[model samples]
Target: MALESLDRSPPPFFRVGFAPLTKLFFFSALSVLLMFGDKQLQFTKPIRAGLSTLIMPVQWLVLQPGQVASSVGDYFQNLDQAQKDLQALQLKQLQQSARAQQVEQLLIENQNLRQLLDLKNTVATPSQVAEILFDVPDPYNQRIVIDKGQTKEVVLGSPVIDAGGVIGQVTRVYPLTAEVTLLTDRDQSIPVMNSRTGARNISSGNIMSGTPLIELKFVPASADVKEGDLLTTSGIDGVYPAGLQVARISHIERRVDISFARIHATPLAELKGRHVLVLQPTGIQAASKGKAP
Candidate 1:
C-alpha cells in the first residue's frame, strides 16, 4: 500500500504538458486563429516587418560571397573577350593597309603606261613598246636590258626613247632579249645639232668623268656654243632619227690654255623609266613593215 501511494513517474521537468495528438490539434487551431487575425487586423504586421528587417542583413551577408565570385568570373571573361577582339581588329587593319598600298602602286603603274602610249603616236616611224627588264650588271657602262629581242624583230642599233627623249641604242640582241647602251656609256657617241645655232658637233660620253656624262668633243673655243643650248639628233649617223631631242647644254667651260671648249649637257630622257619605245633605225625606214633588215 505504501509503495502504491509513492509516485512511480519521472520528475515534472521531464513530464509533457499534453498528449502529442492533443497538442497538435490545439496548435493547429491556434495557428489558424492567429493567421486570420494577422490578415484581418494589423496586430502581428509590425512584428513580421521587424523580423524581416532584422533578417535582411543576414540574408545579404550569406549571398555576398557567391555574388562576389560571380562578378569576378564575369570580369575575367569580359577582359579575355575584349583582348581577342582587339587582336582581331589589329590583324584586319594590317591587311587593309597592305591592300591599300597595292592599290596605290597599281595606280602609279597605270599612269606610266598611259604616258608611254601617248608618246608612241607622235612619231611617224614604226615603233613598238618594250619593258626594261633590268640594268646591265656592268659598273663600267650605263646599259640596260629590254624584254624585246630577235624573236620580236628587235634590230641591232635600234634607238630606244622614253617619254622625254633618246635614252639608249640597242647594242646586242638575243632570241628573247636585247641589251641597250645608254648615251652616257663610255664608248657611245651621237651626232648632235645645236637647235639654237644649227652647228653640228660630235657628242660623246666623257671618259674623264667616272660618272655618266656627255660632252661635245673638240669644239673650238670660238664656237657659238652657249649654256642652255638645245641639242637634237643631226641624223648624220644613220642611226638616230632627225630632230629628236638628245640633251641640253648645261655648262660650258672656255679655257684660254686649250683650243677646244668644254661643254657638258644633261640628257633629256628619263633613265630610270620602266617602259620605252624601240624605234626602227632611220637607215632601214624603207623596209617591210618595220621588220629588221
Candidate 2:
C-alpha cells in the first residue's frame, strides 16, 4: 500500500516546484551573461571566429547558385548592348560612305570647270581620305592630326580644305599620321584675293579674345574694297591653287595716319568638324605667245 501511494505521488523532482524554477533562473542568467560579455568585452572572440570558420563553407554553398545566375544575366545583357552599338556604328559608316561619293562627284565637276576656263588642269591629287584622330594636344595651337601620313604619301604643305572653304595646311608629318595647322592659328598665313574685285591681299590669323578674326594686311586704302566680299586663294605662292575659297571680309577700318587699311576676315569653314579635303597644287599652265620671226 505504501509503494502504491509513493507511485501515485509525483516523482521526487516534480514534487518540488522550486527545481524547475531554479533551472529557468539559471538559463536566463546564462543568456544575460552571454549578452553582456559579447557587448562589453572580447571574451567571445575565439568562439565567434570558430563559428565563422565553420559557417564559411555553408555560406559559399548558399551563394554559388545566385552568383552564377547573376553572371549569366550580366553577360547576356552586355552582348545585347554591344550588338546594338555595332549596328548603330555600321549605319553611320554607310551614311558617310554615301556622302563621300557625292563629294567625289563635286570634285570631278570642279576639275571640269578648270578645263573649261583653259586654266591649268587642276588635278585633284589622289588623297587618302583620313579620319581626324584628334585635335592638337597643345591648347595654344589650333591644329589637328589625320590618320594618313608618310605611309600614305601625305606630303608636308598639303592644303587642307572643307566643304565651306580652306581650313588649314599640313605642316608636320610622321610615320602613320600628319598634323594640320588651321587657318585660325596665330602663326599661319595665306595669300588671298577679293572675289568681287580680284584685289590681292595677305590674310593672317589673330587669337585675341572677342576679336578672333583673320587680319588682311597690306590692303591699299585706295582699293575699292567693301564689306562682305569673299576672299579666295590667289595661287601665286604655288601652295594653294587659284579659286579655292579662303575667307570672307567682315570688317574694314581705314585710318588716315596708317598707310594700309585694317581688315578682318571670318573663315568660311568650321575648324572643329571632321570633314576636310587635302589639295595639292596643280602645275602652272604654259603661256602662249605670238610667233616671233
Candidate 3:
C-alpha cells in the first residue's frame, strides 16, 4: 500500500500542463505579433541595413559568375557592332575618295580647255573644238577619231592643232566623224622649216622606234640643224598653217660614211589630251555632205 501511494501521484513540478498543439499555437501567434510590430514601428530596419551592408561583398562574390557572364555577352555584342560600323565607314571613305579624284581630274581638264581657248583666239585660222571620240582600234597605229567631220566642215587634209602645236591632220572624213592621223604614223609626212636658218626639212614618222618619234630626212651633215632647234610649218603643202610648231630637234647624229645626218625630233603637242582644235584655212572649204541617215 505504501509503494502504490508513492508512485500513484507525481510532484507538481513534474506535471504536464498543456498539449503540444496549444503550445505551438501560442508561440506562432507571438512570432507573428513580433514581426507585425517590427514592420509597423520601423524596428530592426537599421539592423537589417547594417547586416546587408556587412554581407554585400560576400553576396557580390557569390553572384560574380553570373555578372561576369552577362558582362562578357554585352562586350561581344558591342564589339560586333563596332566592327560593322568600321566596315561601313571604310566603304564610305573609299566612295568619297573616288569622287574627290574625279573632281580633281575634271578641274585639270577645264584648265587645259581654257588654255586651248586662248590659243584659238590668237590664231588667224577659223577653227572648232573637237573631242576624241575613240582610238583607232588598230594597235599598230597611233590615230584617233574625232566627233567633228563633214557635218561640221571638218574636211580632209585639215590641220589639227592643240594648245602646244600641230597634233595631226584629218585623213578621212565621214558625215559626222573624221579620222585624224597622228604625226607618229609610219605613212604620214610633213614639211617643216627650221626656225633658225629658214631651211626646209621633211618630217617623217618613225615606225621602227617603240616610242613616239619624227625623223628629218636627207638633212645634210653640215646642215645648220642643232639640238633644241625649233621646227614649224613651212606652209609648202598648204595643209598646215604657217609658223605653227611641229617639232623640236632633240638629237642629231652625223656619220662620216653617210652623206646626211640622222635627225630625231619630239613633237610639242601632247596626244593624250581629250580636246583638240581643227583649223580651217581661209581658201579651203569642205564640201557639203548628204544628211546623215
For model 3, give the 10-residue run with minimal summed lDDT: 283-292
List, residue by residue over 1-293, the lDDT tens digit for candidate 3: 67766766678998998999999999999999989989899788999999999999999999999999999999999999999999999999999999998898788778778878998999878899999889999867878999998989888888999888898889999999999999988888999999999999889888687878899999899888889999999987767778999999998999999999999999999765689999885337322223333
Better of 1 and 3 by lDDT: 1
TM-score per prediction, in order, is 0.69, 0.54, 0.79
Better of 1 and 2 by TM-score: 1
How should the candidates be ordered by TM-score, best one leading? 3, 1, 2
Q: List the residue pairs that clash in candidate 2.
A: none
Candidate 1 structure quality by residue, lDDT tens digits, 1-293: 78889988999899877899999999999999999998899799899899999999999999999999999999999999999999999999999999998888778667767777887787777799999899989878889999999999999999999877889799999999999999998799999999999999988876467656699989999999888999999999878888889999988999999999989998889754478899999888855546854
Clashing pairs in 3: none
- The reply for model 2, stretches above 4 Å from the true place, is 1-125, 283-293
The whole-model C-alpha lDDT of candidate 2 against the native structure comes to 0.78
lDDT string, candidate 2, 1-293, tens digits: 66765657777876766587899999999999999988899789989899999999999999999999999999999999999999999999999999998798678656543332332233344333456788888756788898888887777888877656788889999999899998888899999989899888888887664555788888788778888999999988767877887888888899999889988888987544454566654432211122333
Residue pairs clashing, model 1 = none
Model with the higher lDDT, candidate 2 or 3: 3
